[model samples]
Target: MSYQFEELFADIQKDNRKVLDDIEPFEHPLVVLLRKCLEEQEYMLDRLIEEFEEGKTELKDIKTNCSALFHANQKVNPYFAEWKRATGWIGYKDDTPSEELMKSLEERLDEMQDDLIEIAAKLDEEYGESTTKYFIPTFYLPEERVN
Candidate 1:
């Protein structure tokens, strides 16, 4: 069953000083519980990472598909064509993507990328620039108990 992690953690943090001050150095129940909760959180965090990876893959596929479609329709509307990387040339005489549609798609893609960056920032403030995971926890942690 699911646990009220926030409440449990908060309550322990509030009583952290007392627990450490009064209890023996041996394994305390609160410490044990908090450790278990953190382990469970690790699993949840792993899932979040997996989902982010999936989203990034999906975004790449969408960008590739858009480029292919634009290239395919370039035969009818050269003005709406994009630069071709392979041939070092601009669009062909394409008609599939009208100027308006291309503009809209570009705008939508930009928005989608922006959204992805925002989510990445939440998972990692530097967005993979730093070595650490940089995940901000949802719950406060109890301080270490010393002998």
Candidate 2:
């Protein structure tokens, strides 16, 4: 695990460290759900790392996988920031991200086409075809993205 991961885990465990319980909620359910998903993912990571350290779970080829995961995580940060800015999720400051940022963001999204397609399919299945018109956006999340 990276030091950044460890630091995040430590903050969650430490009584004196900051907590996010007091943070105000966003107006939109989409933004709120996104934040919740990210938070849950972090918590899962913390648990996985803790289990690995406790000898309760085994890591598969840690040197290779963790390094790859770390590199992927690093690349994800800037793309996520750009996506949030473009979507106006972060704040009122970024009404529009730059053209370069949009291209970079789109490239990252393109990399996840298979996953996006699967998710879209599942969403369509669960919510019905008509529900997708409101929930599954194809303009930003292209239908051509399907693998």
Candidate 3:
């Protein structure tokens, strides 16, 4: 099947609407909190990719960035780590999470997704849809996929 940008965009828009609806009415700080979390995630992810592509993916650098991103995210929204543990989003790790922690993480992910959508929209406007192209190719294995 052919790729469908319109469908993906529509899905993102729907998610944005749901995120707005689900947020607590008086939780005004969530907007900025989520924004910071998303921004850090985006920045760190970009750096991680650049270092990896340049054959400089040192464990120390990776760990440093990962820990910094995690801590920064926790500062703004502690729920991110909790949600990852609760939802098994930790991937290949076997860490048990409490119910309260899971709930908090779920809330943070919901908020963070909205902030990501906003950032993506801004990037798209500035750099065109090609902005997404920067990340997509990195998602695949170089040996298995054509450039």
For candidate 2, the C-alpha RMSD (Å) to the true structure equals 13.8
> What does candidate 2's lDDT look like per residue over 16-131, in tens digits?
11112311233344334434543543454456456445643333323233333233333444545544664555444434444564455445434433333443454455445664
- What clash count goes with each model? 10, 0, 0
Candidate 1 residue pairs in backbone clash: 73-94, 74-93, 74-94, 75-93, 75-94, 76-93, 76-94, 76-95, 77-94, 77-95
- Model 1, residue 72: distance off in Å is 20
Rank by lDDT, descending? 3, 2, 1
Model 3: per-residue Cα lDDT over 1-147, one tens digit each? 001222332343344344334432323344446545555655665554455555533444454554444444445445444334434543432244445544654664555444444434433444445443343222221333335
Which parts of model 2 are misplaced by more than 4 Å? 1-23, 60-147
* Global lDDT of model 2: 0.40
lDDT of 1 at 93: 31
User: What TM-score would every model get versus the actual structure?
Assistant: 0.27, 0.31, 0.34
Model 1's TM-score against the true structure: 0.27
Worst 10 residues of 1 by lDDT: 138-147
Candidate-wise lDDT, in order: 0.31, 0.40, 0.43
Comparison by TM-score, 1 against 2, better one = 2
Instruction: Please identify which of the two predictions, 2 or 3, would achieve the higher lDDT against the true structure.
Output: 3
Model 1 vs truth, CA RMSD: 25.8
